[model samples]
Target: MASIDLYQIPVKEVHGVKGKKPEELLTLGIASVGDLLDYYPFRYEDYTLRDLTEAKDGDKITVQATVVGVPLVQMYGRVKSRLTCKMMADPLFITAVWFNRHFLKDQLKAGTDIVLTGKWDQKRLHLTVSESEFPGKGTSQIGTLQPVYSVTGALTQKWMRQTLKQALTQYGGLIPEVLPQELLAKYDLMPRKQAVALLHMPGSMEEGQRARKRMVFEELFLFQLKMQAYRALNHDRADGVAHPLDMPLVRAFVRALPFTLTESQKNVLAEILHDLQQPFSMNRLLQGDVGAGKTVVAASALYAVVKAGYQGALMVPTEILAEQHKRSLERLFESYGIQVALLTGSLTDRQRRDVLGALQMGMIDVVVGTHALIQEDVFFRKLGLVVTDEQHRFGVNQRSVLRRKGLNPDVLTMTATPIPRTLAITAFGDMDVSTLNELPKGRKPIKTYAVTHDMLDRVLGFIRREVAEGRQAYVICPLIEESEKLDVQNAIDVHAQMQFAFPDYKVGLLHGRMTPAEKDEVMREFSANRVQVLVSTTVIEVGVDVPNATLMIIYDAHRFGLSQLHQLRGRVGRGEHQSYCVLIADPKNEVGKQRMKAMTDTNDGFEIARRDLELRGPGDFFGTKQSGLPDFRIADMVTDFEVMERARDDAAELVRRPDFWTAAGYTLLREFLQREHITDSELLD
Candidate 1:
């Protein structure tokens, strides 16, 4: 059968999947036989038989024994029951108990031999049975590694295992191998079919590990292949804009800045300038820690592009950020004759029309806006460059749409959220990365502390002292309003409490629930020192620059990821004065405590990001779905990073081959990509 036909076989057609079982399987994303085959277990349970004498308390083991008595079913509270049976394993007799499994009473007869797997209590000679099997019954799960899947309603692990076994038996042979034979031998990888079989039914833990390694490599390799293809296609495109390299003009503008640019910033700016001079469009990611002066580097790039007789568009995620960038860029380029305009959703209809007209007529040299810049009516006459701020906040399609406004315009994406090395190479693998590691001179590191709720009064007192000395402070809460489910403090209540605590100081509130105008007003007041203390939510987590703000108090700080806490801390320390961040949290778990320790230990965003990835995993680190990261079923972004790196290297070499896609050895890969709809255009998208 053809691979496509085999993949299209419905789950209902499988031998064991009947009735609502197909629907249940579908809920787990298994609609077809191919999906079922690819539905790998998230983990496995070991049922390898062990000697009863060697077992210790709380040890998960499987013991083979002969039933000495009939199982007894005892009714418990409110529809609950327990089934117990006495069994003899050589010199010792043990009792096995199953909760809510009363049906097992009829199955286990006296003198019947069976194998039971569960957690053992040695003193009581008891096994709390999770699984059991009769010795001769063909359905025995004993002495085998049991695959445990993540299932949905009515989809039990036993049923899933059986259905997967049936699917593999019927169609596993038809599953094609995408990796070439030479590559497999070089990596010492198992055959594709063998790996799949081992994953579902591994003989031992080592076998399972070997199988997992192969799958991880394959997933990473294919992902890197797609990224490489996108990069190649982007480079080969005919409509790329090769902007003029006017370094003399750009350097003069840089020289006129009030402060000297750090060596790291200069190096990164040089990299972006070089990309602008290329014949192909620039697709680059500019990453830096908070207050690392990414905006200045971006400004230089924008100056270079506008000087070359082209318009530029800067897209940010929030309206407040858009406005801030506009004002700063305008101030930066006032003497350089570059016109910067702000276009955001909050603009009046007449103001929006004027900005749109100016952009279309090339009157605006650089336009800063939120998603409003990507609206259908917005037009750019000679747009040569596109810069996206906090790039991860926007979706891939949003970025693509803004890029589409110009004719293959050079794209530069900037993010303050420092991405880890593993994610940088995989998630942003298609783009050239530039990092700014050094902060501007004389900038003091923010002092950080983790304290319990009892320290709240002291923290507030410290903030009052800072405010009394003419510095602003920020109080952040987890929620905008009270939530019945969440016990964390809310911005509204915090704002009131802050006002009451500091009666003489101005207390302002800002949250996501506020309209853009309301947020901008509160921010304006805070920026100008009219508001001494600002009580807000994470809405201020990004791009809120208050030079005079020297203190930040985060309530329930453990509720946030390390990177987020780091970002909030960044709001302060922007000026020459000393800054401090107080984390008011009573963490209940080791991971939470570790996060607090990591925050108090280092001020480095990169280090914090790495730790965040380890603690929260990739999904919660940056929200993989929104961050353009693929959801790998078996490959973990943390533990399997080395394998990913190897796969990336191999993929780069493979893509460089002259006859990569057309080669006979790559026939299966080509077909797989096609089947998955991974076209060159979609790869970049």
Candidate 2:
């Protein structure tokens, strides 16, 4: 028989496979043998032989024992069967139970030696197993470290292991090696064929770890290759207009500010100014914590662009944020003889047309808006700069479309969500990064507290008292509307209850479901102090800054990530009055408790972000798609930082080689990247 090409053979053709029909395989996304190979185990079970008599509670163990008596088989409803048997090990008796294995009754005979692997319950003196096999049978997977595949529908672990074993037996030798042999030798990495075989069936623990490291390096290396490719492609892609540094607008704007700019802010502004003067387009990310005065720095850049006879656009994530920027820019520029316009979805036809006309006619020097600014009709006459606030909220496509409006206008992306330095570099290697590490002086930190659900009433009473003292308060709920799937407090329900609880105070509701106009109006009321208590969702997390709001209560706080909780807390403590954040939650798990504790322990946004990254993996910390990072199968952004660094350096060097794309090993690597949809040309385009 011809050896099957694992990449081309369908999974349904594998021998000794049952329970997985062709259509059923499609449900699990297993179209070919290659898909099965890529379907890595989420976790592994250590089935190394262990002493049954010394087992502890909740121990996953494997043992070899002889059956003491005939297995007692009991049938459940319809097609299910349960088998129970007792085993003897010198001085102790152990009971073993298997579920839904009716065939085991005929296979497991008295006095037969068998190996059982399962979770042992000490109190019940029984080993609970959904899998079992007799020793010396054709099955070679028992008593060894085994992979537990994530199954769907009627698929079982036994069937998947058997089918995958068949594939490995037939075609594991044909698994292509992508990394150059010299590179693998330099890193002391296992060969790709050995690693693939070991990942599915490792002979020992050390071998498995070595194989895993090789796989991780390959994944991170591919990601860095894509990033470096984009960076190289964009080297001279845009013929950016170099604005003159002799413009006096930036100096005058800084002098007119109410407070002295922090040293970090000044340094970041200098970096941005240098970028603005470059002949090539600027792709930069400006990251700062809350109250770091990033807006003022951006305003300075906008002022410089306007003074150089060019228009600028600032796109924010929310309508309220756009309004806030518009008002701030108007106050700053109107006094300095620069025109500013606001464009948002909530604007009427005439209002939008007027703003568009001003922008097209070079009358509006700076326009602040949300996604509406990226619409087809919104054109700029002399657009020189484009700024996006809360950058992670927008995707690469959105930001790229906005930049396309202007002929290679300098791009400045700002985010209050402070990512760790290493992750920022890995995720955004195509862009230059600047960080504002210092907050403006005199800004007080929000005092944070994590309280149980029973103390919620006291927290509410405190909010009531704070509002009564002529200070407004914010109540944040995790959900906008009641969700049957997720049982948590919602903004609408909390808004209704607050109205009844505090009859005299004006409580307004704000959630993502509301239109842009409604959200903006509610935010306007809250900012003006007309709404004594604003019950809302995370919509107010970023840019809704009300100085008078002195208290923030996050209901069901455990449902939120630590960084999100920190952002919510930042909404308070902007004013002179002492501010407080009450996290009302009864955490059901240790991770939830750790998140709550992390929030109350420190007010530093970066520290909170680091802790959040540790608690939740990179995928959940800031979402993979939002961060523009690929979903790596084995590499972790946290634990494998050193590996990623090495891989990044290697990739950076590899891409510079003349034959990198066509070399023998690299040709296979390129094909893998193409299959994974990480092609350089696709992303660079």
Candidate 3:
């Protein structure tokens, strides 16, 4: 490769000019041609112009003709400035215009040969300039392919254009190729530097797309390697929780239940049993849709631990959940004389010490709590089974550390979010997964219906009917207050109106702003049937399973994720009685109406999650943040499920190669190591 003149560098290099010093370019970290190539165009700088007669509305292009007349300033309204210039371009006359760019006031002067690139606002027959620069010559022979660089605060387009122009100064020479030889040939991938350069300054759209394909492949490859390493290091022998799957305790606990287990529950529980029998540690995810009877399945595992003479540790996200779980288990254990203790940060020092002492003494058969269960002072004498409620709510490391307290405790993680099957495989490759897809037997399916705010009166009438029938209700509002800053609904106003509407009955309010004690009191009131109506936020989603609460009315239901709405609906229907879920939505917004309709259509969480993913598109399903899952910027777990499956298989096979960690994958390793900000990497380090 030989160097060439800086002036002839591609348009992108000039479009990517950085800061004042060349050293400042060092921090921008243009370490590899791949790095530079991966940066995408913010928007198109389409200089694709049309002839005067062919120019349509909003056409961005450039034309060079002698400015036959002076540029005139035309201002309209309180804020409108337009620079229009009439020029002769042969048989047709062209009018070039610039908007609001007052600097162009002098630049588009009379008799100046100005080449303007702008959109043709056709209604006014004006070529409105988005940007303008002299092509250094009359547009008589202008270059057709122009580069548009993504601009940043420290770097102006002109500066970037200049700097990138400087880097590509040696236009005739190619940069060093970094991909391994065999892969380069096998995949038919272009030389690394050439691919990067092409992406930044492609001759055509097809070439740019091809470049994108290669870069996306590389990113996913590195991510695959990282996931592979994580699985290997975490799942190897001397690696798993050796479970004493004591069937006697499990059978006794199951037989004691008043209700029959749903086949789905039995099957998932059996899967957990099988995993316990394996030599490898039982790192399993129990994905149950909202109201899928996850608690009962967990109780079976806890019983097994106790019968096996080992302790079980169940951790929850909130103190209320911890206490609720403890109360449920305590009731279950009381039948068999088994012991369960609850611990939380709110516990008095003496009470905590007593719980900790009992735990270390092996006196506590099973322990349930918030983070207090994982404290250094809280040690289990022979802890073996660990269950995390709402696993997604806990950080990966936090979950791992809690598990670490025991002797390779078999970990049972449960989530209300029913992930699609494909994502479950890739994101949870190291963990065995069991899904409880059915509600426990005798549990009535909640009849769901969608209603607009206009139908609120009828919905309220139905609620009144339920109340008259001696049933309780939950009126869920999306927000806590009418934030002057946001347009969200607040629970305060809703509770006030319901209080007025249901003057014959008691109404209670609960929100995040309320203290734990306050929320607990409200839930208790509703649970005991003291409050006929509880108007609250999502706080009610995880409230105790009240058998008599038959109505769940959600306002602005579209504001919630489908999974969440399902959880809210699950709050009711725990009883033998038929339940109703009323979704109050805006009828005008067809999209919102459709989303609410879909929720009313099915109670299956997996189906809802799939539909929600489809409705929200994969790229934005997680709401624009890199999720807590694997680092796949290019391969979205939600969108690129097919690609992820292929990549996962390919990666697994790649690891089988004797020389996988050899020089062949050095660049891939370096790429994985670049993500150093990771906090919880025990799973996919």
State which candidate has the highest lDDT.
Answer: 1
Cα error, residue 63 of model 1, in Å, equals: 3.3
Q: Which ten residues in a row have the lowest lDDT in candidate 3?
A: 1-10
Q: Write the per-residue lDDT of candidate 2 for residues 1-685, one digit (tens) a residue.
A: 1112565787766675445376677888888777777667666788788886677899888877788877888998988888888886445577889888767777667788888888988887888885666767785556577877888877788777777778778768777776778789999999877887888888777888998989888888877877765566556555787888654657877988888999999999999998888888888889999878999999999989888889999999888888899888887777778988889888899888898998999998999988898888988998999999998888888899999998889999999988887788777767888999988888887888889889877888898889889999999999888899998999989999999989998999998988887887898888888899999988899877898999999999999999899888888888899999999999999999999999989988889989998999777876767777656676788888788888878887887787877776577666765664555445442
User: What Cα-based lDDT does every candidate model obtain?
Assistant: 0.88, 0.83, 0.71
Of the candidates numbered 1 and 3, which has the greater lDDT value? 1
Ranking by lDDT: 1, 2, 3
Clashes of each: 0, 0, 15
How close is every model to the real structure, measured as TM-score? 0.91, 0.88, 0.81
Point out where model 3 deviates above 4 Å: 1-46, 49-71, 74-81, 85-97, 102-128, 132-151, 161-194, 248-256, 422-430, 440-445, 587-594, 610-627, 630-637, 657-685
TM-score of model 2 relative to the true fold?
0.88
Total backbone collisions, model 1:
0
Across 111-150, the per-residue lDDT of candidate 3 in tens digits comes to 6765666666667656666666665654432444556665
lDDT of 1 by residue, 212-329 (tens): 8888888888888777666665567656888976888889989999999999999999999998988787889999999999999999899999999999999998999998999999
